[model samples]
Target chain A: MKEKRLISRRRAIFTGLTSAGALLLSGCLKKAPPTYGSILRLGDDLTYLAQRGLLSQRALVMEYQQTDITSFPVTDIGDPANPASTKAYSKEYEALLKTDFKDWALTIEGAVAKPGKYTLDQLQKLGERTQITRHSCEEGWSAIAEWTGVPLAALLKDAGVLASARYVSFYGFDKYAESIDMLDALHPQTILAHRMNGESIPARNGAPLRLRVETQVGYKSVKYVQRIVVAEQFVDPAQDIQAGWSWYNGI
Target chain B: MSASQTTHSETFRHKGWVKSAHFVITFAFLALLVSGYVILMSHPRLYWGKAGNDLTPALFELPISKNYHHGGWAKAIPFKNLKGSQVSAARTFDIFNENGWGRSTHFLAAWFLIITGLLYLLAGIFSGHFRRDLAPGRGEFSLKMLWRDLVAHFRKQSSAPGKYGLLQKVTYLSVIFFLFPVVILTGFAMSPAIAANYPFLLIIFFGHQSARTIHFFAAVLLLLFLLVHVVMVIRTGFKRNLWAITFGK
Candidate 1:
């Protein structure tokens, strides 16, 4: 009788393990974003799903007082005017730089009813929102800076994002590109920041325009944004998955 | 011997749940250690306060260097120092270049450890396993007994065939109640969304960098515990201990 009970318990454990294996296999069978190594794939999925499920769509990250702003380190400077590194420099960006970015306009296109270019003056006309938020980097550092920009939601509303729109992609003058989900794109704190600490953003700090994805790690907030593209899906031929950075790094 | 009279010398007395939990935690801890070490090697430094980077001064630094080849020791790569007072050398190891894999494995194993630990705790509590087997008995509470146990452990005196000593009980309890929670909480404090959503976590750890520092030390403590645990198992009786843990025979 004891042996029978033990066998039954073992069978129960086996059944449970088999079902879990089946569930994990099913997830891998789907057309999901490229996952990490086999050992980590399941946990990655769990974390992504849990964060999305737990947090409200409009949940705001903690905002701090202006006085709390600290020394935000300047990084990733792209000098388009420098002829020494022509590969990194864009002629169009150099021209705009000569004119103090007056001629620079951010072209918003893809999955939108009204696709057009909007100047810094035009974006400012949409109204500005200043926020003192911490920029948390994936490399393990954080700093507080007050950002002044137009709420991305207002721009999306004006452009009339179509029902098919799901992800928002940003192209930068420095040949850098990144994308964020529509959920983050429509976030109240998500904006196209033009000024930092009450002044026009310096060259080292994405002079013309930049993105502030408050909900994500600092790399998600691409600087020197030249164009905005709304897409139905995330297509990263650029090897974000192959490199080890998760596409949905909400934390 | 009567069937009702429990034999203290029986090595296989532990239930199936204890055996299962032990195996799970062992594998999970091994996986965590390997992947965590790889991740640490990527940025072999610790810091304090809210922020740290290549620019900021590090609190501590490890001597490990990155290498592109598969050769050991001799093939290590060196850092290229930049001509700035504010910056540290751009140093990296390229042997695995799998920080993505390392991070993924680390988190996966962490979840496994957490789930198994919770199950063990719950089962231990409800089934009286903790009280019966782990909690120090009346005789063990005496100062003489406690001192004897410590001396025995240090002197390599073999314990009774199956039962744990007072020192073992206290160490096990500390690992379960204190070290485990510290590592988990510090890991959570490093997450940006979680930290930002609950700013109090930042205050509690003093800052994210401080949390990372604590996490590193706690992991080291865990490693030390694991080393002593394995040594004790071997010392008591390698074959018996191994068989008891694996098959509960």
Candidate 2:
């Protein structure tokens, strides 16, 4: 009788465990995206949450030797011939470009004690850093490039970004816009790059200035940056989000 | 014999945990394969170096073409433009687009497969299931027996009941221990965050793109394994095999 009771108990436990496993798996399989048009975006959400919670805020991306630098691919969104190209070269950008970007200045504003525009020469006078790092693109390519620029943290500190600022948004001359969390904004490697491969950044490569966000995907590093906005909350760039890109593309 | 008597006849069955794992793995593998294929369709070309794109040379290119009408080889592969007439243009079979859903579901299924695989491995090892059932015994490892097994398959003669043949055992062991692990590791090596943190993975796998190529081939090998597995199951008593796996009868 005891043996029989024990066998039945074991069966009960097995059945319970199996049901639990099934339930967990079924939860993931639920609401299968119908016709691929009704795709779930929750996967992106889960990844963002997990990475944000688990990964170290201060962790640095790997850097390489100067010899490791390779020919970085130029994704000229402004080029009409490129697939899914964008006309980022607005009229304002054209006017700025016509003069070799001599009149161009990057404006810092919002949630700051001091808000003003700083010229390329003024920005260059600030502390700078040089590093060789791989830029991994979402389109399945990567290249190492040496960048020299003013550390964004030093610039932000000088501008006196308020304690209330939670996000730092970037506006580019190409009309490409993006924003980053405070943690990313303050990361040591984050910078406003002016030089590529020990020379002035070329016009095609976002000349005068570009943002180098070491930890994020290449697209997050907005090129030809014109403005920076500090905010208390994140403002999603809806156009890019609708184009089917994860808002947080650290991967 | 009566139907009732035949239904009650003695049959070989694996343990409960083994049966459950098999059932779950079948679904997970299928999900992974479908989603993986969908994601691959978006970027069909494979490259060897760290960088590649439309302009860069590719190691291998799929029989696919692109246009504005369809996102990929889906709907129809673009043949040529005929005087700006959509209908006049000829297009072959291609079912591209849905990259959004493809990427999302691919990652989801990948996570599911990884979790299920880990649980299955732990359970299998702890319960002595793999050693008892999967590991080949003394005589089973010999080349002569292996040739005999291969010959028997070609001769259309089914092996003895209630036992895995040498080829089946070896294939399963290698896939479980080597192929799946390599696929998972290579997949991680392709991730920017992971790759940036561990550049050594790039060195080990040659480059990021090479890791991606390795992942693709490993998945293809798994597909081959699945094809052979399904064939063997059908050839050897299909109903009996299904019953054993499902009910452990």
Candidate 3:
């Protein structure tokens, strides 16, 4: 009787392991967002789906008052103190910085009916919005700051976005790039920020232009933006994915 | 012979589903703790309120690594009302920053833990396991009984085989009902997306940083509970306990 029981127990364990493996394999079969591995990507997909289902598309993130604004620190990767680490910044950026971006122009191209370059002065003339919102980083730190800029949707409309456009990609002068879905691109809070805290954005804080995706993590707000591309397909920022960062960091 | 048969029959204490959930959550918890530590090593400082960073004053700091104030604290400017407590943005040393895998593992493990925990909770309730096995029975909550259990534990006297003592029941109940829920809620509060949808989480926790601080403490408590639980299992009868929970023998 004891031998029979032991054999049955071994069979039960085998069956349990097999079923668990099958379940995991099924999860792997589903297409997921870009992450480090299939398992991690599956987890990201679950989070993305759950958040998308629960959160309102138009719901705004929390906004604080001027008094609530705190000391916003620049990320180490973009630290002006370590210019060598800022791989995207080049000699061209240095020249533009010397003239305070006077010669700089933001190019809007790809999937746009009227692809054109707009100087800083002309871009600001399109529209303007200011908001005090918290910039939450994935590293468990956050800061609140007031940002002033023109809404990205305004820029896209001005460029006459084509019907084929599905994603908006932002490219920095330093070669860093990031993209957002049309939902976030059209978000009222999403803007191409030019000024921070009532002053021209400091060089340490992405200077003349940066994308402010208030609803997502701070990293999604790519700084030093020089070009905007409306894309017909999902534009994957290869660097971020290669570094194992989640493509859709909604939170 | 009759007494031996009765004891043998009672050896199978755990239900099949309970054993499965227990093992799954155990694996997930282990993954979470290790990955959580790796993530924390990247930035070991804790703060209060909505915003905190290298340029802000930290409410609490851990010296696990050189990440804290590597460039030295900022000098106080009396006119500016600065207290010189903020960490300087310039760092003398590079921060520990290999947390990409850690984060992915943490999120993945968290999903497993939540699913398994929810299943265990629903099953425990429906199956009367919480009432019949986990809950303190009549007279079990009495001070005398609790004290007796505590004294017996200190003396390393094993409780009855296949039965939980008063102290065990209370600890299990608190862990299941209070501690796990608090930890999960505080975790959600830290997520910006979740907070955007559920602002009440932020309001309850006082802010993002506060939620992080609370999450850290709750995790520590859970760690302590795990240690004590493993010790108790070993002290009682490692083989018997393992067999009962694993094969439900």
> Ignoring the other chain, what TM-score does chain B have in each prediction?
0.81, 0.80, 0.86
Q: Candidate 1 vs candidate 2: which has greater TM-score? A: 1
TM-score of each: 0.80, 0.77, 0.85
Model 3 docking tier (incorrect/acceptable/medium/high): acceptable
Candidate 2 residue-wise lDDT, B1-249, digit = tens: 223323424455688877877777788788778877766665677878665544345788765435212322212211121222111111232435555555556666676678778988999899987887789886668888888888877776654556677777888899999999999888877765566666677788887778888989999999999998888676665688788989855
RMSD of 3: 7.4
* Candidate numbers sorted by TM-score from highest down: 3, 1, 2
> For model 3 chain A, where is the 10-residue window of minimal lDDT?
A74-83
Question: How does residue A26 of candidate 3 score in lDDT?
Answer: 64
Per-residue lDDT of candidate 1, residues A16-106 (tens digit) = 9999989976764453454645435556666666666566757677777655555555444345455554444888887888899978899
The C-alpha lDDT values of all candidates are 0.74, 0.71, 0.78
Best by TM-score: 3
Clashing pairs in 2: B73-B94, B73-B95, B74-B94, B74-B95, B74-B96, B75-B94
lDDT of 1 by residue, B147-180 (tens): 8889977766655656777888888988988999
**TM value for model 1:** 0.80
Report the error of model 3 at residue A183, Å.
2.4
Q: Give the distance in Å from residue B124's predicted Cα in candidate 3 to where it truly belongs.
A: 1.5
lDDT-wise, the better of 1 and 2 is: 1
